[model samples]
Target chain A: MLTSAQLDKPIVDSDLQREIEHFLSYEAHLLDTNQLEAWDSLFTEDGMYWIPLEHGQEDPVGMVSIAYEDAILRDVRIRRLAERHAWSQQPPTISTHQVTNAIVTAHDPTAGTLTVRSRFQVVEWRKRNFLRHLAGGYVHDLIKIGEQWRIKLKRVDLVNCDGVHDNFELFV
Target chain B: MAEADPNWVERLVEPARVHKAVYTDQRVYDLEMERIFGQAWVFVGHESQVKEHGDCWSTMIGKEPVVMTRDSKGDIHVLYNRCPHKGAKLTAEGCTKHKPMFRCPYHAWMFRMDGSLVSVPHRHGYDGTSFDPDDPQFSMTPVARVENYRGFVFCSLSEEGPDLKTFLGGAITSMDNFVDRAPDGEIEVAGGVQRVMQRSNWKIFFENLNDTGHPIATHESSFLAARKTSKHKLGGEVPFQLHIIEGNGEAPEFWESLDLRAFDYGHSFMTAIFHAPKGKISEDYKAALDTAKGKEEADRIVSMNRHNTIIYPSCSPHTGFHQLRVIRPISINRTMVEIFTFNLKGTSEEYWQRTITYSNIVNSPSSTVMVDDVEVYERCQEGMESDGMDWISQHRGEGRDNLLDREIQSEGISEMPIRNQFRAWSHYMLGTPASIPTGGGDS
Candidate 1:
């Protein structure tokens, strides 16, 4: 329902495309380096981070999700990760993210909003030898404020979102 | 006949301590699959899961793959998920629509929604053979017994035992309160299911359901983090999210103040840890319940708040939160936990959303609280394999429990529930009489 004709129009503005790509790469860098507090600052005050439990899940409130965090809950998550007694993170998870196929799917110049879709694959290692590969598609709703973009919503749809999973200790 | 020595099964459990073999031995797990899971009432699925006719959902009762289906006549059936022609599973582990008939992918053998064989391809090939379509063996076989209490369905693999109601006994009140909390006196399985794998024995997780002493020790990281966040950001008046986590760090005296009740057949429940907070959401939910039922009845209903009710060997229901955690054993050292959230019909959307939020924060595998518990359980599984210890202790307030007619009441911090579980475990593992033991308080 949020689709628009701008999806077909290739982003002709090279400057805007470069800025969007830089923003995504920087976000991935923050996540991979465990800069969660700085990463949290990239979102608006009312921003949401969601991981849908099912494919094509549209409503987080009407259904369940793997991860749905607002600002307060996200802060709690960051705090927990830093706790000394957090046993699951005794040897904290190390991750590397590969992001590609970034596309500006929609743009509303008057509203100062743009929708970007990208594909990502993340490899995480923890507990000395345990490793996992997570592949997903990311959808971001960014609003421009004073020549900078802030994320209003970020939704991640994983290929195995509905599969039985082990403890997810860090952000994907 | 018997696999292991009968005396050894009895020796694995003692009054105040149990041997490590009960958890680490594959021989014991096999006997449990036969005597315990074979006779006990295990949860299959909820009726809401298969509402429409020909809707089928595959799940496991013990180690067997079974399917729960709704037929054209609105009758529900629990059948084995194997094709009679071959031993292949008919469907995967999920909900699917096989309207009118189910055609086996192996040989195209067709069967009705009720698991009756309708037809098979190349029927003339079996004309001279002993295969008869009318024979019961040629059709899908149902479990020994299937019973539905309210909308929840349970099946027993063995034919001889107490009925479902008798098996549930006094603990049935928890199930009643679960459904009656709905304004319309009904609830449906909604949202979605979240599954997590644990590297521990299934009984270890079951025993933890009512163990009040471990929350502060196991979940110290989560609660301390929440407390720090509340102090730094929210000025120390914790919100609902932080409140849930912080409550786990309650002092030992606080936990001792609450009461624990254990019923027959390894069922038990503890008093609510935190009362329903006073807020707009609570007010609105109370108003809706009052509108559906009178204020007096509504007051009576919500006042019966319980924390977690263990239905023994299958599922644990948190009535106050509208969630059920189903326990499925994979192997001796592996377990699967499936959490399901329910929606009370005729309630406000905001109420249901709160339930979903609770599930995400408290029960999901990504939950801050559960991740630590999972780690501890895994550590327990690994530690028991060492040669250092032989018996695990259950000596915390062991003999200080009151025995009633059909229930056991003890201090919330007591290990009465774990001891009581071993009582039922001994009964099942030894193939003893199913009748409830009388006048035995503590030994």
Candidate 2:
């Protein structure tokens, strides 16, 4: 499956590269620090965050995805996580995420976008030991906002995304 | 001799309730495969999954590896994955084209898709003996019965039982309405499959499909956080994400008004939540329906607003969401749920995307809503293991279940659904072939 030949692959300049690194770092910080508020700011107003249920998923129109979220749904999830009575968070998950191999593999300078391929390993801990190693390529679509750069879309493709999961409390 | 517990099952189940041991006991888990999961009409993959010849999908029935395959004649066959030559697994996992026959990895014994012994490598060795390949015992064993309803394939392991249609009974409507929502009045297996493992009893998950009492209390923290985030993060303007979060926090009256109906075989479905304002996509979808299905038919289809319809011990079809969470009990303490997304045959692509979106937010491993639910289920498993209490309560609105012909109705928060399931559980555990209670004498 050609994953967004135009979208999955983008062009990145040095400035764009720097912007993506910061965007990637900030996104990780928001989730790891449990500062979902800050993370919510990363998306474009109409941007989508989609996680396909199947490998090599091509289109999202008629097919069902594992997760496809707009701004509103994303907020609800963040809200649910922060709720004091959230039963799953009786002992909230503690995680230290390591984001590595940030490469600007593709760029779309005219579109103001760049796709970065990166590997990540997050060690998440809760009451009992739940440590998962997730390595994925991140497709980042960025747009310039005056001097700052904001994330339009950031899709993470986990290497073992197809495996049975317990629950994704925090981000990868 | 490590004889299986014959009386252990009888002791675990009661007329009106079930002991948690039926859920968490290892000895009982083995018996379930032989009795319930083995005999019951368990759902395999949809026919669309293996539409072509040599196409096969491997899944488990209890502890057995049952393969749903398409033969050369385009007939569907469910066969045991074992090869008779050396007792080796004949096929790899997932769907794969095995050509005309499957060859065992150990000693090469090839079998046709219909589970016939096509060859056994050195056939001359068996010529002197009575190991004739034509005998049924020499071939891969086919399931007792296989039936398809609206492209959904279900197989039963027992030779004697009510056919799949009679077994599905009223639940067939859910599958019909499932594909009928497709403008073309058909649906296909599409998108992807999401699998989630739960550290609790399979019954607990089944009960939660319509368990209205827990959403407010169990999901309080998540919804509260959703509310708080709207206030602090995005200036109090709720989005679809936040809407789903707070949707779980509906008022008690709202829950009480909605109808919950249970069928004889422990199958049940709830009327859609009375809230959730019709949004842009839904409005667009309604317009499309008016064009495709016309005003009356479309209205009739839309009027059947239902949540999850449990097909009893196997899967829960969310008609509104266009997904099915197929449950497989891996062990007494663990259950595996595979989420399959379906494409409405004639609807626009965007309509399906919304369904997928709902699946991700509500059912995905990273779902904020389901995370908390999974946690509580695990907690229940842990709590039940302790000797503090022997019986898990199902007394909520016990005697108050409203009875009707072929169906029982209860209030939104009533535990009648759980009690209804236990009624079936007792029947199944007691080894009664008629698991569906007649609901007349002593129930």
Give candidate 2's chain B TM-score.
Answer: 0.92
**Off by more than 4 A, model 1:** A1-9, B1-6, B433-443
Worst-scoring 10-residue span by lDDT in model 1 chain A: A1-10
TM-score of chain A of each: 0.93, 0.81
The lDDT for every candidate, in the order shown, is 0.88, 0.76
Best by DockQ: 1
Top lDDT: which candidate number? 1
Give per-residue CA lDDT, model 2, range B285-392, as digits (tens): 778778888999988987888888888789999887778999998888889999888887767666777676667777778787788788888889999888787777
Candidate 2 local accuracy as lDDT?
A: 0.76
TM per candidate comes to: 0.96, 0.89
What ranges in model 2 sit over 4 Å off? A1-30, A46-50, A60-62, A107-112, B1-8, B97-100, B125-129, B225-243, B274-295, B432-443
* TM-score between candidate 1 and the true structure: 0.96
Q: After the best TM-score superposition of candidate 1, give how far the Cα of residue A50 lies from its true spot, in angstroms.
A: 0.6
